[model samples]
Target: MTASKTLNVGDKAPDFHLPDAEGRMISLSDYRGVPVVVYFYPKDDTPGCTAEACAFRDQYEDFKQVGAEVIGISSDAPDRHARFAGKHRLPFVLLSDQDGAVRKAYGVAATFGILPGRVTFVIDRDGVIGHIFSSQFRATRHVSEAIDVLGRLA
Candidate 1:
């Protein structure tokens, strides 16, 4: 399949329908009319991924206050996502991208052509991307960057 161009700020965020931790179908359209933070991580329960997930968990209230939804997506199975979320007490949704199709649709590239890319997209209420941050190592910063952009949108 041909690769789509990487999405950028001002572009329309691609709409997707995926299953969450409990196997409940969740669509990006389900969250329209409110800002959304969609982060694609490498995997569930890995050291860096855990740190990033926990960072979002800690500031989940801040995101909620602004009426923004935070979603973490990885190729991990729904069961592992459920475990990861439960173990960290995460209050946000974690979606499973089993085939990495959504990842490619969003143009979340791999690091060194191997590992899944750690990228975060901040979409405004109108479903337009407001900001995009990608960093493989500084995973926690994705949460901060997303929150910062969401604040500006608010």
Candidate 2:
């Protein structure tokens, strides 16, 4: 399949419907009129991923205060996401993008064509992307960067 074009600031965020850890369907349109932070990570329970998730968990209230919803996506199954979220007490939704369809739609390129890319997108209430941050090695920074942009949007 052809790679999807990379997303950029000011572009409309792609809408998607995916299952959360509990297997309940979630749609991007469901979050319309509120800012959303969508982050794609490589795997569940990995060191960097854990750190990144915890960082987001710790600051979840801040995001809520700004009226933004945070969502994490990975190729992991819903059961794996459930375990990961439970293990870390993550307060946000962890989505199962098992086939990486949403990942490709967001243009999250895999690292070296092996590991999945770590990228975060902050979409404004109007559905336009406000910021896009990608850094496979600096996973935790994704949380901070997204929050920073949300602060501006707020």
Candidate 3:
């Protein structure tokens, strides 16, 4: 399910407070003053989601080198996120959007009938969205798109 409004480049990325894999509440406001790559995927351990996540994990250090943060969000519960992150050894944060309020706020819609949409937003240090990438099939492209935005921002 998506919202009536879809966020666009230069719009302020919507703020959200969701739980991470460890049940720790994390808010977008907390990452203020840093560029953030926020990605929304369908599920925890699915094929495409896993590929997208691992791609982010692989490039995590490069993001850090440029002073950016990476976060992944899904409707899965905290425990499921924990297991998925542990199994994949994902170094970045994975937040549980259990009620999917965050996804709705970001206007990430359902794709291919029921699968949740795959979207990535690169928010600059000022909190304005610098880039938006949406592709349900080409999952890994989200990471590269965000990285390119952050690279330019850096």
Candidate 4:
């Protein structure tokens, strides 16, 4: 895969329309005026991805309480995403970016020599990136850190 233009803090998130686990179309514009935590992962139901998803699942209520919405995106197809979300009981939507359009747009697609790096983009109510977290193993911390940042903004 070619290197993609990485989105940065304070940059407006690239708008996208991807099918969720249930095959319902979702878009960044739909959530305008709401803080959003959009996370990108490698695959659905994989060990690392599960950990990351579950971490967000565990924190779903807290996120909603803060007036934010959390959404996970991966290159998996909608059917795979459906099973994964059902199996894990994920509360938030799991977007299917099967063609990697959104994944590449975010610069998180796997490249020649690296596994797809995990990335989190925290968008404030005005739709500007407030924080970006990149990690593999300790993805749980990303959720915590995002909550902290959102709290400060709140």
Residue 20 error for model 1, in Å?
Answer: 0.5
Give the alpha carbon lDDT tens digit for every residue of 20-131 in model 1: 9999999999998999999999998899999999999999999999999999999999999999999999999999989888999899999999999999999999999999
User: Estimated TM-score per prediction?
Assistant: 0.97, 0.97, 0.96, 0.92
Alpha carbon RMSD to native, model 1: 1.3
Candidate 3 per-residue C-alpha lDDT over 1-154 given as tens digits, one digit per residue, 9 for 90 to 100 = 3354789999988888999999999999999999999999999889999999999999899899999999999999999999999999999999988887889889889997698999999998889999999999999999888888888888
Per-residue alpha-carbon lDDT of candidate 2 for residues 25-72, written as tens digits (9 for 90 to 100): 998889999999999999999999999999999999999999999999
Those runs of model 4 whose alpha carbons end farther than 4 Å from true positions after fitting are 1-3, 109-114
**TM value for model 4:** 0.92
Name the TM-score of candidate 1: 0.97
- Name the runs in model 1 displaced over 4 angstroms: 1-3
User: Cα RMSD to native, each candidate?
Assistant: 1.3, 1.4, 1.7, 2.3
Full-model lDDT for every candidate: 0.92, 0.93, 0.91, 0.86
Candidate 3 Cα RMSD (Å): 1.7
Candidate 3's displacement at residue 130, Å, is: 0.4
The best candidate by lDDT is 2
